[model samples]
Target: MPQAKDHVYLDHNAGAPLRPGARERMVEVLSDVGNASSVHADGRRARARIEAAREQVAGLCKARTRAVTFVSGGTEANMTALTPNWQDQGAPYYLDRLLRGATEHPSVAAGGRFPASMQEVIPVDANGLIRLDILKDMLAGGGPALVSVMAANNETGVISPLAEIGAMVAEAGGFFHVDAVQAAGRMEIDMDAWQADAISLSAHKFGGPQGAGSLVVRSTARVPAPLMLGGGQENWRRAGTENVAAISGIGVAAEAAEKEAQDWARLAALRDRLEAGVREICPAVTIFGEEAPRLANTSCFAAPGISAETALIAFDLERLSLSSGSACSSGKVSVSHVLTAMGAEEATARCALRVSLGWNSTDADIDRFLEVWPQVVDRLNPEARNRAA
Candidate 1:
């Protein structure tokens, strides 16, 4: 599908534009023939492609090559990490409790394969920052727990204090898992530095194809049990034939994202400028997680009296692509769970919008938004428009 010349895409958080290298790599793999599980040369080649992708993904997190297990996407990676069936001396070991931050992506927030009765949700501060004190208290009362926290939030771009969380979990003798899907390509991740027992990643979040991701455990010797039982795929950690084409794209994309992180400062300036422009136009516009650490390319903000659904429709009509603060469900912009957890008023939460920039983003995209947004606010809040005028 050809894109309209005037159209602009700013919702990189939802899914980034596919990288050229990744696209080419995926197409190349699509032309190849063989199942990775077969013993023939064709199969051996396919297996090689899969292994290379695993190493590429592991390199992104500075994880051991043996620790990476390919999965379908972030959801599966998270599910595999959350399952309480890690092998300990050939016996099944289960986490006595499961805890997750309130602002985590739905995959982690849903408790993955863990039972709902065994799970507890941790609260976050009004700024959408995790409440460390609360987390510590929650851990104190629990047995060996599996604490899952996303390295960065998808909606607000708020970064968690991973090193601190990891330390606390380690001291409590619990395993710490990081859903680094949003953080993977945007920043450097060291499993040991964050003390993460396992980290989940998705290719589509970082300019790769969707449908391929990985769960990088800290050690191969103590990996989680497979969620599905069948073939010896993914070292018996996951059952299913590998999505070879998508995996190849993921490998190429990860390599590119790692290199692109070096030039993230360029996007930082663009993002800052975008946020500044919006605030200047509407003084009441409040940028979420502004006081907390955030991704360089992400800006989530809202103005009073202007719901995101209204603005999203206007922007879409204007050929400007942006996302609501929360996930868009069934073509509708629902109130942001992230904002609600931050103690934002219901109306304000409904008004929030997220604009995430990336490698393909340009000043023109921001310019278009700045131009169209005022018209939206004017229509939604005529009283505020009068005050601004």
Candidate 2:
């Protein structure tokens, strides 16, 4: 776990601090004892709470209330969306195979429950945007397919051309699923406008409890089959009893996150300032996706001559929290698959560092970064950095 104190935290892409509204509601629901399936009044209250959360999460995607299905987290939501037709034998579903973005989260890129052969990648450009021409050529001859593209990337914060992608998928008669976990609170996403068939969201990414998430389908009639069969919950779209407190937290957090999205301009300005400061410290620093559309609160740059591992250790010693691309696997920094998809050279990709801001970030945090970051960069020698390069 990332230890946070008086230290500055620039890893909101990993997790945001829990919102007070969510915390309060979670505590209240914690003592309201009953399974959502029972006939008693307590059960009725629990069910109502869960349904209310469904509506709130749906609002974040501008989706129908009936189409939302609660899940464990973003991973389960992505996994569930990919395998909806897994058990429907002898019935022709709308989609026949999965085509995901090369830069998708590992959960979507590598976590599909379908057979490996059924899944393939859609490449991206150097700016981290999906290559539409290549995608069109791939889609033209395939059987009705399922396309998985993220609204915003977790690593470079690159925003995809969703409306255009949706149009292409529609023309090809395929279903479009968006892994929207990173964009939930930072940007507005309307299912109708984006033409997404299914969307996944995580609570912790938007100031809610970490254990809850949602999959909001564009149409209730097209809900995916439950991944497991434990009990009659979520109208059979998902099984197992709901987590009452966590669901309540998601409800309040969603409502709060909607408000948070309104302040993105300010966050984006702050991010730009941070990037400018980084450039002054090291003129050769490269900011990924700098010329493309991206989330307002994210800045990913590689200091010209420093390895990310050395920079991370130096930053930690200075009490500043940052990450090299997305959260590393098992606390070990590995080369980013996202940068790789954008065709980055091995050394450049390995040295990339991501600094993500959030709702609580302020001028002080930026100042701290500007103050200590130069020192961290100045301490590294190019000759010593070459070994890791």
Candidate 3:
């Protein structure tokens, strides 16, 4: 068992370590007692904090503060975005259809379960990029449609061309929804610039408190009927008392991340070093999405004959915490849907490991990982060592 002292987390993609600032903010908010919707002074203070968070989240996405709607997390954000508003008198007929990338996170994928005939999957290329031509074709043939494409792949970190896709969707008079949960804070995200009707973001992905996320909808965009209705919270789009503390933490974290955007460049350098070390130590290893632009702090790699589960366990034994893919899944060992969509062989997909970094990462952290990685790989696949010998 790895002790806390030995563990070097490389699973920021799963969730970054909550920053001290975010924690302090949470503590500060928790000490207060007020319902944001109430009319009292304390309530007004709470509402102010919530509004500040809305602005911060909106700024992160280059959206208007009024366009931001808080949700429980990425899953809720996705579900809310995908849900249709039958109540809208002018709702498009295509609103009945939900088209998404086949490699989308389970939340988006599961949203398709509403009815198979009403759902369509846009295929991806060998590099895990959505097949834009197919998307254009589908849009041209569409009904009222909701197209959900993740801005960046959670497993492979391959960025989707949202600007292009959003334009295509708009040309076809369809709603464009982007799952920016993984893309937020890692890269520039401009909801208006991308022309995205809606985008989802999770605070935990960028050093904020977990259980807090937001959906950004264009001011011109029509609201879907509420996914949950009661108490008329979130402008009646979502209902429930606000999570004031978590939202406050998200605001602090977003402000910190915005102020330190250059940190991503630094983390990219460390990521490159880690990747270079892995390639040097294991020449046969294949890095996924190497041909395309990716998140600065993510590197997904695969080595023949060594399953991700094995490598993960070996690394864990060495006190290096990493992920096989999205932490939303149960087991660390599974064939990566992203890899499969990208045309990776089952063996290669199963062998892939995702090493992600974040705000807490340092040069020494990367060095420590490089130091242990070779031994972990060797221990998991002694045959590779024997072959080299």
User: After TM-score superposition, what is the CA distance of residue 274 in candidate 3 from its true location, in Å?
Assistant: 0.9
On lDDT, who's better, 1 or 3? Answer: 1
Candidate 2 C-alpha error for residue 303, in Å: 0.9
Cα displacement (Å) at residue 181, model 1: 0.7
Q: Spell out the clash pairs found in candidate 1.
A: none
Each model's lDDT comes to: 0.87, 0.85, 0.83
> TM-score per candidate, in order?
0.97, 0.94, 0.94
For model 2, residues 1-389, the per-residue Cα lDDT tens digits are: 74566699888998888988899999999988888898899889998998898888888778888888888899999988886273223343646678899999988987477678888799999999999999998899678788999999999999999999999999998888899999988999888888988899999998899978998888876656678687778877788879889988988889888878767888988998998887776777789998899999999988766889888999988888889975556888898989988888889888899999887888899999999887786687443322332
Query: Which residue pairs of candidate 3 clash?
Result: 93-144, 94-143, 94-144, 94-145, 95-144
Worst 10 residues of 3 by lDDT: 85-94
Query: At residue 63, what lDDT does model 1 achieve?
Result: 90
Deviation from truth (RMSD, Å), model 1: 1.6
Q: Which ranges in model 1 have alpha carbons more than 4 Å from their true place?
A: 89-91, 386-389
Residues forming the 10-long window of minimal summed lDDT in candidate 2: 380-389
Of the two candidates 2 and 3, the one with more favorable lDDT, higher being better, is 2
State residue 312's C-alpha deviation in candidate 3, in Å. Answer: 0.9
For model 1, residues 89-174, the per-residue Cα lDDT tens digits are 56777788899989889888889888899999999997788899999999999688999999999998888999999999999988
| Collision count for each candidate, in order | 0, 0, 5
